[model samples]
Target: MASKKRIGLYFGTFNPIHIGHLTIANYMVEFSDLDEVWMVVTPHNPHKKKSTLLDDHHRLAMVRIALEDYPKLKASNIEFGLEQPNYTVNTLILLEEKHPDFDFCLIMGEDNLKSFHKWKNYEVILERYSLYVYPRVSQGTIETQFNNHPHIHKVNAPIMELSSTFIRKSIQEGKNIRPMLPETVWKYIDEMNFYK
Candidate 1:
């Protein structure tokens, strides 16, 4: 019998999938024990305001484009069909039940680790899945606090200060956003006039 592949679930709105997103995903696969990383595109994040979201399909498409060159990375729209205001715990539960063969881990930035306790059913998450946390700028305090969690693993990747919000703002302001995202993703965003 063959062993099941280890999968990491990287959930995000990915409002516009940028190079930073791809870089971290690639880093996880290249440097960690996980065999593949799925960029789980959430339809809507419970913690974020809806007004800030781009269309889920568009965001998912951007993720696909951004990861096109990396065969180990995939874009998942699993939450698109689920109910709105998606929670990580619920997604984890569903994926676990649906695919029991693969070991699952949650990939996140240290910034998210700070307010993790406020997330719905966070304790359950901590108990069930391992967390791969990457360091981020301005993440000093939160990273220190989560260092004690049994399931938590720290990852070091080049810190790209770019963010979706900054990309969106650049687009809206008619500034060039080509440098912030992957080439394919930038082309797709330009063709679709996304964030404009």
Candidate 2:
């Protein structure tokens, strides 16, 4: 029998889809056992203010354009249709029901790992699916319980310190941030005069 396709869900606001995000998603699909990586554009992150986000359609459009060249990486607007302030648990449930043939995993950075326990039904998530974590330059130590856990795979990927916030600030400051974003994405943002 054919094995279920493995997919890593990398959730983010992606206010602007920059090269750092592309690099991480690309690395996960290339260096790991997962078949593909989906960049899930969150409509609203509970931790962030709504005013700070770009319009949902704009953010999703940026992701779509940024991933045009990467076949193994896809832009997912799955959460766009979901209820506002949706939790990861709810998304996982829906995804499982919708794609019975795919084995989904969570793709996160080392920083988020420290706060994993605080997420809604995080334990249930760990019990059911694997977490493919990438390196990040973040404060705080990981919980001891996550140490050597089979479900949590700490991949030796490069540490990406670039952030959407930084990019946005640079653009607002009239800095040349084009190199930080995908060429196509940069063009889209420039054409739209986003963050200016």
Candidate 3:
């Protein structure tokens, strides 16, 4: 009798899942029509190098810790079981089969949007799901490319210029990363000695 929750799939490596990532997901849940936002952690990106990535399980754990306070936010390890060189199209299709009752949308930063055309099965992705894009500290090239797509909507989230790469670098250098992530997440990272 209860209605299924509308889920937004926010796929990313999440390398560390910092405050900036949380801010965008929170904004989407609060401001958009979606009922929840799932941080889908990708094991590996075909386009990105895996050399700089932290362990997938560790990254997922950090995401869980970061989102513990928000009941509507969840961290998913769906890609963990999938074969590597993770592709968004495949992940979306699998999620569709597994969670049939929930409505799904794709969430990404403007930077991803710009390079989305180069993604595998990009056309299928565009046709099947709506895209919710949050601005990042990058040139406005992505916005321009998809300006005509009716399914794409721009989100007005806080401009947090921080990044996972920055956090990782800070940790490697033995600098404090508390200011860049949520308190609970920072605690986990510190306790586990992640990125060190």
Candidate 4:
């Protein structure tokens, strides 16, 4: 692990990549102990309904566009080719097998910690890798259960109250969503007539 780069896996549906998402990933690479951050774009989140999300390719494209300016940050479609309802543990396992030279860490919001136990093989994930958690809007008061756990670390990344659902609604309602997203992504969305 000492010879490889410390990579943080930032998983999300990224319905349409927003500045908030990029902010967290960039902050992790720039401020945290992580050497790089990969935006693992999920095709479908078990917790979310499939109909509400954009196609996997579109979401992947948006992530790619949003990450163009960030060299240390990458957009990954690792979950797209994986099994149905791609589980985090499975993704991590595959990543480890595929890239033995990388030390992978899980990156998520503090809110997720509140329901960490609900995830499949949560204990194994906690025991095998580190978790870099950042604050999110509406995700108040992180749970104390993992406070003493050495594997979980709190990251002081910028927290944006914005959400993809809000952005999509804004777009659907004919309100401006430009402020919440990168210019390139906004342009692409407009060109593709997405979320309309």
Candidate 5:
């Protein structure tokens, strides 16, 4: 039988899809063994406050617009079909069940590794799936708490300091946000009068 495709799942709110997000996804596809990278838009992050988050639909739309040109990158709304407060573990379970042909791997940032234990059923995720962790600006190194397990691989990527919070704040403050977001997404945000 033919081997199944390897898919890396990058979970985030994607309040607005930015260059940092694309750069990481592109790096994973070009440098890593991952066959494709799926940007999974989580409507609700359990650990984060939802008050400032853009609507789930809006976030999904922007992600789609930003990632449209990349063949190996995709925008997924899988979390939307599932239950609320989309936990990473639950999304993994659902994806595995629905798409048995695609071998799923988890992709996260070094910063996320700091509080990974706080995630729901994190142990199961670490044990059952392979993790590709990228470096984040000012995050230092991986915490000593985590071992250099074979399942967890460190991807050699540049540290990126951009963040959705900063982008949103700049938009609200009437500052130029063109540099932080994809042109299509920036246009969409402006046309829709979002984040104002």
Candidate 6:
């Protein structure tokens, strides 16, 4: 029998999908055992305000365009159709139901892992899925329980300090932050006058 495909689900709002996002996704798929990395464009994040987010389709489009050249990378709008205020655990359950042949894993930053214990059903998630964590510059220390956990793998990928909020603010302030984004994505954002 053929082995199940290992897919890494990198969840994000992807307000505009900058180079940092692409770099991490590319690195995960290429350097790790993951067969593909899906840039899961979240439509609504329960913690963030909705007013600041662009339309769901717009964000998904940007992710799609940014990943055009990377065959191992893919854009997924899986959360777009899900109910609002969705949790990661719920999404994982749904994904498993929909694609049983694919073994899904979560790709997150060290900052997020620090608060993983607070997530709903986090223990259940750890039991079923593996987590691939990348380094990030953020406050707070990781929980002692997660230290050397068998399911958690910390990758030594480049630390990307860029943020979508910074990109948006730069555009609104009339700064030329073109190099921070993929060329096609920059063009799309410029043409649409987004975040202006």
Clashing pairs in model 6, backbone N/Cα/C closer than 3 A: none
Off by over 4 Å in 2: 45-49
Give a tens-digit lDDT track for model 4, residues 124-175: 9999999998986654555566886899988988877788989999999999
Instruction: Give all candidates' CA lDDT scores.
Output: 0.84, 0.92, 0.85, 0.89, 0.88, 0.94
Model 5 per-residue lDDT at 92? 89
Query: What does candidate 6's lDDT look like per residue over 130-188, in tens digits?
Result: 99999999999999999999999998889999999999999999999999999999999
Candidate 3 residue pairs in backbone clash: none
lDDT of 2 by residue, 58-90 (tens): 999999988888899999988988876799999
Which 10-residue window in model 4 sums to the lowest lDDT? Answer: 136-145
Q: Write the per-residue lDDT of candidate 3 for residues 1-196, one digit (tens) a residue.
A: 7777778899887888888889889999999988999999878655676688877888888899899899999999988998777688998889989999887899988788888888999889888888988887776466355787888888887777888888889899989778788998888878887788
**Candidate 5 residue pairs in clash (backbone atoms < 3 Å):** none
Q: Model 4: runs farther than 4 Å from truth?
A: 45-49, 139-143
- Higher TM-score: candidate 2 or 5? 2
- Model 3 stretches with alpha carbons more than 4 Å out: 1-4, 45-50, 143-145
Query: RMSD to native for every prediction?
Result: 2.3, 1.4, 2.4, 2.0, 2.1, 1.3
Q: How well is each residue in 57-110 modelled by candidate 1, as lDDT tens digits? A: 788888987887899999998787777666788888888888989889999887
| Candidate 5 local lDDT, residue 147 | 67
lDDT, residue 112, candidate 6: 99
Ranking by lDDT: 6, 2, 4, 5, 3, 1
Question: So what's the TM-score on candidate 1?
Answer: 0.90
- Quote the positional error of residue 139 for candidate 2 in Å: 1.1
Residue 3's C-alpha lDDT in candidate 5?
Answer: 90
Total clashes for model 6: 0
- Candidate 2, residue 183: lDDT: 92
